[model samples]
Target: MYKQFLIIIIILVTTHKSVKGQDNQHPKWNTWATWGDQNNGTYRNPVLPADYSDLDCIRVGDDYYAISSTFQYSPGIIILHSKDLVNWTIKSHAVADITQISPEMNWDRMNRYGNGIWAGAIRYHKGKFWIYFGTPDEGYFMTTAKNIEGPWEPLHKIMGEAGWDDCSPFWDDDGQGYFVGTNFKDGYKIHLFKLAADGKDIIKGTDKVIYQSKGSEANKLYKINGTYYHFFSEVKADGRTVMMERSKNIWGPYTEFKQLSHAQNDMNSPNQGGIVQTQRGDWYFLTHHGDGDWFGRIMSLIPVNWVDGWPILGKVGEDGVGTMVWEGKKPVSGTKIITPQTSDSFLGTRLNEQWEWNYQPRADKWSLRERKGWLRLYAFGSLERNDNLTKVGNILTQRSMSTKANEVIVKLDLSGMADGQKAGFTHFGHPAYSAIGVHCDGKIKRLEYNLKGQVTEGDQINQNVVWLRSVWGFDGVSQYSYSTDGKNFKDFGPAYKLMWESYRGDRLGIYSYNNKQEKGYVDVDFFNYTFAGPQKTKK
Candidate 1:
């Protein structure tokens, strides 16, 4: 009896410890998501493990706002908000219509894949939020709003001169305004211009070349502690590195210059972003490494230390150059776990904050009021033969998370589909694309997979309600599946390797296009996303 009692007590103790151990594990904001602040008061680098490139961050009171470059996606200039620098969520966008720049996007069939709205800056001055960006083909533009989450003002073309990119705006304490930008056409030099009080017009004849370097861009200007600091990224022999030049006067014979951080550890080309200070006095550099893969330009937050009046990013070594930190103390003390927006239920009146179209969607082609709790995408006529996704407007898409494995499922209603129309889900990127959807032919609806313009037909579906799913593995391999009842999904096509193309990463898209005419449509009920992979822990 004594031996049996001891055995029972040991078993109970072991079970209790097991349960306690499981409970003690750090709670993750997202299990399958790649980058975010770990809930245990620590954060991993690539704080956001996605392609939020050309980043610029600012702190307003206790809140932080960071804006990223969206090449051709509208609404453009994605703005993310965070309470702590580690955890972030999508707040709003700066541009609403792509046609505001050119009608070619909507009418001329000119797909601006990797060109529109590249690398701008955001600033908060006086009582409003100002964002300035440039396009490779069209000049420079600016937009402002009273609220960060806003109805931003229309795009105002400030400069019509070609070949300017990566511009930043700064306002001095003396009520003077200055604009700095890189001129790729004019010997790749950095130029500074004096701006009027309204920040809409440049004071004439104030343009001066400040600095010249090979591939120098991503300009950010700051007046810190009675000194003017100009930060930008330049291509070095080893790789792209963050560079800084300082002066006592805003425009000048600026003297102090140095390379702050370079490709260190696994962070390749960690350059081109701004720095911000937390409420507790700690500073961090928000950057995107230029070593893009299937996922484009992932973002990281590097701790900064001010040594001799300069901000040193990441960790300083014996040589005094900083290396990227994969794990570090939380910049702010908070257990709140937040992440960027994903997954959407069409039940809402407005589209979810996560959704962005390839270009300005034809206002008359898409509607939410037609079917309550459903997103109805009308079949717009395609611009080319063979049904290319780039030529099709209203291709709703969102950024894919950087994880080992992610699955997206969409419930689509095909009752409204017309003949000669194809509507379904797509894993889209230029140079390579794959889609699985229902293709209507007269009265028959057939499931089909289009791989890089090669069409493969599948089993016919009789029902109006169908479910489609796409799964992505860590190795960048993707597979497609479909179901009629939502429970049993059968794999339908060969695995596809996702690739980076045209300056963008792989994006999951919901698309519809017609070869005959703009007649058919598809009703998307909801999009559900789930992830599974190794949990993040301190290394």
Candidate 2:
């Protein structure tokens, strides 16, 4: 029978080449739409350019290095590269000027928008490449290079004070080299300094006072094969537990001190963690948690097992946070997926590092390459949703591409606003800030709600030219609608739930802020986002 008709045409050509290779690897996946859509959803931290908080990892030989905690945003020290640690790629940005950071005035008010750089520390030694960090209020720095990218040499304060935050550095195999100072204050608890072999300052030994914590702060020190460890953490009291510490020697009349990790809820406060080893020796513990506060933090991986010698973390349970475990295709290798990239048919050529600008990133306001793919935004000075909206300059941010539920549709053809102009879409955090605009203030206006800390009126519309929409969700849910001719959308009412002050198991996205101060311009034309799961349904 012709072998059953050639086995039914070879099983229908292998199921049509696996559904045409998953529709070319998901082309804006949409199983259905009109709200509550689902069908072929995916994305829940498969580790795609995650928001990266205050983390710092290291793993030499097979390669793996990381850096986080940018604080004031800018292109500050963000150098990631991996290899089987579950994909990662951001080859540069170890301080791209801004006067090599160190020019603040109101950071003493605890943290002004310019909180400078926060916790970062990556080491490589001998072959060169170090990066101790601090600048809580300006001071305690170190930068080196044999190549981590750059002629990196411009910040070297080492210790100036104002609570020199998270500073970690160490080198030992007998020839010695150390530094483990994190927020020193009550008699400078853990402070061991000794380094100077062209790796930058603090070399004559004298600052040694090991373990001292009434609570805890980012601290690290390791030396496996022959025993010698001491890690630190603590900040409970309901603020989101963290407690952890261990010691053995190197200048420590040290003991045990344990509590390990807490906060299964209460909005996780995992805090700083870093440790690496695995050429086969196995041991990992890179951390950061708190991915909400309008979405901005996520990175975790814990699996510390040293039994009789101390250290036995999560072991990958109790949701003690865990994720990266590559060893297979070896993560960072030319990498690509470009992430949810927030569909913008306004063409491409730039502004897709997940777009961010809160401090220094000015290119005449905005434009994704002048008239090629269209995304021209130019309006600054009245968008005062405050966070220095007028003085520090209006903001435009990104980082929340989806952690399951999703919908970010943006399409504008403003017809041009002229007269204190105002353009739309926003949701920045810190005392919360929200938006949905399209105004002229002289004839056409709309203010579509949620501008945290102040600013209410979740909906409005009056046309001079029309086509506007906004929808943000998750936790303090939200939904605003408008349309004069973009396919029926008129529902700007009671669907609001934005309490804003988030940072508790996070993920959320989409933004656009315009305040027309001098020039005034906005021509987005296209931007669409998508994500949804529950066994999928709508496309």
Give the winner by lDDT: 1
Off by over 4 Å in 2: 1-49, 53-68, 73-115, 118-137, 141-158, 161-166, 169-178, 181-219, 222-226, 229-284, 287-398, 402-405, 409-418, 426-441, 445-539
For candidate 1, lDDT tens digit of each residue in 1-539?
99999999999999999997655332232233335677677776667767788899999998899999888888889999988888888999999887787765553455677788799899999989999998878888999999998899988888888788999999999889999998899878998999888999777689899999889998999988899999988887787778889999998688899778765524467788999988888899988874547777778788897877888887776666776666678888855887777878888778777888887787888988889989999986767746677777788999887676789999999999999999999888876788999999999999999898789999999999999998986677888999999999999889988878888888889999888877989999998887642245347
Error of 1 at 166 (Å): 0.5
> lDDT by residue for model 2 over 284-303, one digit each (tens)?
66676554444455565555
**RMSD in Å for model 1:** 6.7
Please give each candidate's TM-score: 0.92, 0.34
Worst 10 residues of 2 by lDDT: 29-38
Off by over 4 Å in 1: 1-34, 532-539
TM-score of 1: 0.92
**lDDT scores in order:** 0.83, 0.56
> Given candidate 2, what's the lDDT at residue 460?
46
